[model samples]
Target: MKEFLTDPHQIERESMRIIQGHLQLDWTEQELKIVERCIHTSGDPSLEPVIRIHSQAIEAGLEALKRGALVITDVEMVRAGIAKKQLAQLGSTVECFLSDFQVAAQAAEWGITRSMAALRMNKERLKGAIVAIGNAPTALLEVLELAKDPQTRPALIVGIPVGFVGAKESKDLLWEEHQELPSITILGNRGGSPLAATCVNALIYLAVKREI
Candidate 1:
């Protein structure tokens, strides 16, 4: 146990333990994993992470992914964060269009973030997939728009895009505009690639084997 003292994640582990012991909150095992990972990623155990899942969306997301559903990410960092090898065992793949030429062209033409354009361009491909957006608020907005079309109904939307501009507003709109859709967002302007990727990884871990 000598290594535990210097482990980078030790503080995060202790913080979660304290929260779990002090709070009477009735979070499930899976939910607690998300919360702890969020805290670990952000280094703020006090940051109340928002979990807006409904009607067993967590279970649904895991099941959909296990059934070979596509996992689309707004940034390559998110794709990199996920345990793709474990996901591949279920015949699933991680996709990120940050480098797509069409996405860049579309974003430039519309004066929007390429991440948003990536979401827009993949409307058809998004259906029945799990979308995780962690960088641009515009990407969350575009997902909401595409979600309106019956053909673009994603299994779940993990919208924790981080920024000072339009981040909080975009997340609020996700709840206001599409409350019926299953979603998880880091409320306020306090989200990032790490938090978004953590949420996706949590869901994937439910159905896939992983090394801690």
Candidate 2:
């Protein structure tokens, strides 16, 4: 039998220390926190090179959280993984519209994915909100369309959907063409709900300067 750290806090501290030691980036403290969280969630030190953060993304997310921005996630799993207690403390709210009746109707009507339809149906709600897309590349693509109208743009986009299909391309487009948009993303198809949610929670903690 093998023994390991049993205390959650101790385990987290050890994990962070290990991640920090492995990270080779020159990212700022806040940016490093986001990357640390992603690597921690994925349990992959190799993620150090693939993780990308827009210069202003951390600040944008923090400011929005401080202002009680709405948080919109592409899937229920991402929404469920967010730190609700921290969000409540910040006076922010998190929501996933994928299961909403209107979103479903729009999806069927447009012959699009529910993820895409959810973004279209809630474009208005995206304004200045923090958006997290962890499961569907289509949703990330759809949000990029809505972002063309600057007034409807999200404050920060955590676009890290996991898949072998359009996921890598969607994130690539986000980084290359959407330089004006503040965002954090993985360069490859190596992201998921927990990774996306952890990025949001990292921002929440950074917003309050609370110790993780």
lDDT of 1 by residue, 51-153 (tens): 4555466876887888999999999998889878778888999999889877778889989888888888778999989999888898898898898888998
Per-model CA lDDT versus the true structure: 0.80, 0.93
- Candidate 1 matches the true fold with a TM-score of 0.87
Q: Which candidate should be chosen as best, given lDDT against the real structure?
A: 2
Residue pairs with backbone atoms closer than 3 Å in model 1 (clashes) = none
Off by over 4 Å in 2: none
| Residue pairs with backbone atoms closer than 3 Å in model 2 (clashes) | none
Residue 90, model 1, lDDT: 84
| Candidate 2, 21-102: lDDT as tens digits | 9988798878888888888898898998989999999889989999999999999999999999989999999999888888
